[model samples]
Target chain A: MHIPSWLLTFCEYLEQTASLVVLLPLGLAFWRWPRLPKTMRLMTVYLVFTELVLLASSLVELYRPAWSYGIWHFFTLVQTLLFFRIYYLTLSSPAVRLLIQFAAVGFTVFAFLDSLYLEGLQQVNSYTHVAQSALLIGLALLYFEQLLNELHITRLEQDPLFLVSTAVVLYFSGTVLLYVFVNKLSAPADYASHQVIYTLNSMVNLVQYLLFALAFWYAGRTLPSQSRP
Target chain B: MNSWLLPVMLATPVLLLLALGIVGFVLRYQRRLLRQQEQLRQVRDASQQQALEAALLAQEDERRRIAADLHDGVGTTLAIAKLHLSTLGQPNLTEEATALLDQAIGEVRRISRNLLPAALQKFGLPFALDALARTVPADGPTHVIIEQRGQPRRLDPKRELIVFRVVQELLGNGLRHAHAETIEVSVDFGPDYLSLQYRDNGVGFDPAAGDLPPAPGTRSGLGLTNLRSRVAVLHGTLRHDSAPGAGSKVWISFPIPYLPADQKPALTTSV
Candidate 1:
């Protein structure tokens, strides 16, 4: 793949901008408000970790070749782990904590095998991507059930749970559509399809970040103010 | 993984997910705050109603105490005075002197009975109501009847007192204001409900009129409003049905639980 100099600069700029825009606020939230809900804390940590991975990926491509593959594998493993956690919290009943433990062990074993066997790296990556996407879609469906009779406007007026649930649905749907159509339409001869897929993916990313911020704000200010120790 | 492609893809989704999570948290927090506010409002309303009822009950207790003191202490002293005066007078004493002592005794007795009816404390509601029925003038065109349909049960003293007082106040108002000749008091005891109905044959007034009577002694310039307040606290419904020259009927229905301890009277026996 022949990369233009301008496109490289743009990618680097995007990397720095995303780190500042998303990670900084999340970092501050975790530091100042240590008493945030477990769900929210998990999400914030996930955000900061992802941002650092992306930064490392960009830094590896720009300045460090020998270490790039190792960093990618490490971040990919982290991404899979975080996705599982999000799915577990959003989908499973609180009483079913045991299932999450089983999932963690399963994913850890899979990640170790994928890292050790470099010959099957692409296959492992593709498998993890599909599994992660399936889990998110499943989670989104579970939350949609939580909001079965719930009207979006009614929730916007009264309930923050409804708002969070709706956001999750939108973000999950966006990712599903983007990924399913990404390779099929974006062949080398057809640059237009590739650009469209990337644009749609970026838009989905933008909406999801905004929604996450809203969820955090609601959690911090509107939730029951039992003086968190 | 293309070094550039992997990070770009990962970065975009992560940022978007964070945004969605943030929004969810804010909305949830707002809902919680609103719920707490509504709960606080309900608590305040309930406390206010309770406070008003408490103050009214205290006032009634004070009035009952004062009425008792006058009847017992003052009536005793006056009787003793009458006895002494009679002893001091011999056969030689003038007719006017004896008549004066007798008149003084009658006045004292009337004052004591009016202050607190003896029937109320001794015989319960039915007997007291019969006494009230007798007080109405016989010459009036309207006839008054007091009837009990089912076996009567002894209510808790607190509940019985309120029912009796309300009935008294309602009847008194009818006599003074309704100009009705015939008044009927009927008590019906069903499986779950106890109903008291007072119907008069006078020119009825509009219910929407601002001058409608309040609680029981309120119309009598003493305790009607307080009586109504007490009934409301007992979770009973008091309703008024009236129109011009149509007569007035007041119905009070209460769900007083039937306990084994409640004494059931044999039947409707006249006072």
Candidate 2:
């Protein structure tokens, strides 16, 4: 496939910048640490962990390129667990929380299987990524249903969990396709596929971080939350 | 094998647009739901206000009936008894008995007037308020001072009654509970509003506690709650300024609708 060099450069810059945009939310979360609710605090922890993982993975890539994929495989599992914790805290239904607890255990087992047997550490684990996207997207839908059932939230825009769930749905659903074909298409010589993956994923990732920053900023401004969870 | 690079590139923007579209839809739908909720709340509030207004009107009607009965039936009967006693010319009938009969008649008249202020109905709020202040004896421990500002104009009889009741309660609470020494009431009539300021050198309370010192013994008598209801019906704003040991001051402002000159019939009076 013939791809424009300018587009490739833009995609590369966007990819590098998108990951660091998590700092916006991270700074806000820290600044408003005392005021944030349990869910928002948990999200802050995820943000911190993500930044750490990004830094660690970059270092590993420079030192040992072969093991870089292993770091992301670990990241996939941790990210799922953190999100489960976040949603579990916000969702009011006891049955849903229990279902999520079970889902957490189930996803952990699947992630292990994918790493050891299905897609090995050297591969992109497109199956795991697709599954993660589907599961998270499902959780986001459940959250939306919960919001509808409980209209207690007077200001939906300021609600931290609402903002976070939106980011989750958009980011996961946006990047699910990229994840699905990334393994097969990421051959060393397939420059066009790399551009497609980096460009699409980075754009959505930037949006996710910006939304996250807004959520954190709102949480900081209002101390006594109207949201039940 | 077909290269999916072209398809992926094309589909990615479409997917992003789809996600953006979903977010937009959710926002619009939620706002619509919220607007519906707000509209329902407004309807509920309006219904409640109507119910409250009806209850207050019924209470006033009842008061008027009771006052009429007391004055016409009870007072008249008492006066006839005094007349018959005087005509009997009995030796056993002492002067004390005659004096006590006069006091009883006076008491009945006072109670009847208290139930429904005929002065307020006949004259206006300012006149009724002045009459109320005069009820506080000059020799009494508490000295009442009434001040009026701007041109005096008559309001709707029902509205005057509401304002009268509010002032009546304030004075009653201060006299009965606080044992105020000097009470000052200032009434300001703006071009389109009426404001009242009441200050009493009484045992003031912490306004922050949001509690009134109980003035018991008057059942069906308008208390602070009823006072607030009356103010609400008038669409008036009330504020309190006081602390423990300091004198309490209350400021009330009620918007008065402008009645044009052609609409003016028995509306203006001397203060």
User: Of the true interface contacts, what fraction does each candidate have?
Assistant: 0.02, 0.30
Per-model DockQ: 0.04, 0.45
Off by over 4 Å in 2: A223-229, B89-97, B206-222, B258-271
The number of the candidate with the highest lDDT is 2
TM-score of 1: 0.47
Residue A184 of model 2: what lDDT? 73
My TM-score estimates for the predictions, one after another, are 0.47, 0.89
**Candidate 1 ranges beyond 4 A from true positions:** A1-229, B1-53, B88-111, B211-227, B258-271
lDDT of 2 at B4: 69
True contacts kept of 2: 0.30
Q: Which candidate is the best by TM-score?
A: 2
lDDT string for model 2 (A1-229, tens) is 4668887888888888997787899999999999988888988988888888888998998999999888899999999999999889888799999999999999999999999899999988788888898889888878877776666676677777778888998898888888888887778777767766877888899999999999998885653323442
